[model samples]
Target: MAIIKAVNSKSSIGTAINYVSKKEKTEEKLISGIDCNPITAIDEMKATKELYDKKDGRQYSHFIQSFNPKDTLSPEKAHKIGKEFIRNNDKFKGHEILLTTHKDKKHIHNHFIINSVNYETGRKFHTTKYEYQAMKDKSNELSKDHGLTVPEKTKEKGKITSFNQNKYRVMERHFKGTARSYVIDTALAVKKAQGKSTSREDFIKEMKDQGYSTNWTDTRKHVTFINNETGKRVRLANLEKTFNDSNFTKGGLTDEFEQTLGRRERSRGTKSIDSRNKGVKRAYEELHQGTDGQGLNQPPSSLKRDSGDRRGKQKGTRANDFDIGRAKEHIRKSASENARSLGELSKPDARTRKIEQEKARELERANRRELERRIERNKSRNRENTR
Candidate 1:
């Protein structure tokens, strides 16, 4: 696993550059620079800093990328990975960077020295905790591409997945400061709550007890949640990934609730074609299975007969206004035109078609000849002008 660390160094930039770019510890070939020449990087950096008029307390920012010794990695690959680590990070976009790969130590590592003042914008480099995590995330990405070792993430506070000493690697980047990040975070917390609640009511109650106002109903299009204290509302449908194809277009909270209960009561829920035993399964089926326990897959039956045809359009709504006689007349006229067109296609004239094709070919040939003549005239005119 490649590990990355960043430190704001108060020491001299020249001293760090010399220590990193030493030929005995690492070759000049391995030492590279971004937006500047490695051999005269210090001079170039000083010029940029002076251009920005940054007479400074902090000289440069330092970063270290060290690799796991257990993995067999080459120097070139390691250097390439280190370069990518800088290039891929958006924070280092306009900064001049000095990168050197050291092979002298048992554990191969790369040193990154960056100019504090950006060349183009003259902006000083600054980093926060979030920015450091972003760098670590980038390092993990580059390391994975090269099949290098990557360190497992440490557990964060407030998340409850670290029980039983289990290593849990879930969730992903909440991109672009969008609402989807909060929705996914809510899903993780809700999933943890679901693990303890056995029934649908119990699950909703648990979420309420946890201070999340449950807005999930079987028919509601969005399984929304409201934070009681903060008064923040988020829709699970906002994530746009329901992950279920059935009728539960919302978060499928109801389905999840019932499924968990079913898994728990498998002994009493399984019927096994034994009609003699009336178990909890029957009660569950009656509750979720259709209206009046008709069957699990049966659709809800209406007490009154439907007024419309098989299309479900109400009887007096549109059927009464539709003109069947006008429709029949329209169909008859369309058939007549179609038959006339088919009859026209049956009669063919070969000589007329051949004459049209010949006329097209002759016109194309004349255009090509005229183009060639124009090219020859231009060449002759150029030769005369040159002489």
Candidate 2:
């Protein structure tokens, strides 16, 4: 399997590029063997580095690479897969790209170095927030072509294999009560809503309304939570505590309250598997579809996933490229008028300019509000599952 790593380090870009180019296979071998000809590896690196380091005079640098070891994968196969990936992602055409493989890891993986500059405009590339996930998803899709084992969507807890359990244990210890808090709060909210005896069915509905989520870990057999607020891994025991907390139990709430509580419960933990499962079968059904939660499916519906599916506006009314262009033009015109006119004569024009400025300001304010709303919504939705 190939693992993709994209870095925005000014100092590391060159080191990373060179390390992949010369450290593993000779620079010539990479260029000749890889199908990305006319788009040579060295030239690709140089072009990408130049644009990322020079354009807009912004010192911010970024290079993305995909790593797959050579022991498990032949350079020939890796090169083909890399070329295919680039061909499929045509929108990334203008950017410089290099495909390389290393001999260091267990599974052979390839590295893709890309300059984060938009070739058409000689401007910095606006990397999307979901770019990494998109890359992983694409990589997974490509793996099928090579007859490689395509990783299935796994719960965050399930992903903690023996190799990485210690790392997770450390995180779980440090972020104590983080993920579990949400689950506990949701359970408590459900209980309080029904006068200390909420039905499991009602609790599940409340959780769904609020967009909370729950998942089973086939490896661990734990009902893990993706806390919406903390984005931490929450085990089931923590949920029990948050529910018993005084603040949630004392108040009477509607289905909305249960929904909100449910959302909080599921959002505490974050795992890539969660995103992968967005379009898959429901978590509850996956676990309880056949047998009760006792078998492979451990935790049943008192812990329903609040799917977090409801949608709202994203990217608040912030100015677009066109709006910014107009504002710049207005400012230039206003500046010229001030330079040419007498102080008194300029008063009317200045007032008119001021009105234009206010319009721009209003648009900007609306833009900010819209962006903020989207950000909050994204944060909330992100917490809906444990990868």
Query: Model 2, range 116-216, lDDT digits (tens) per residue?
Result: 55544556644442564576668768877776654333233312111123433543543464544343344433344344224335544554454545444
* TM-scores, one per candidate: 0.42, 0.37
Candidate 1 lDDT over residue span 182-294, tens digit each:
44455555766666676667877888878888876768756777878778787665432321111122323444565667777785556553543556677545444332334
Among all candidates shown, the one with the greatest TM-score? 1
Q: Every model's Cα RMSD, please? A: 23.4, 24.9
Candidate 1, residue 75: Cα displacement in angstroms equals 1.3
lDDT of each: 0.66, 0.47
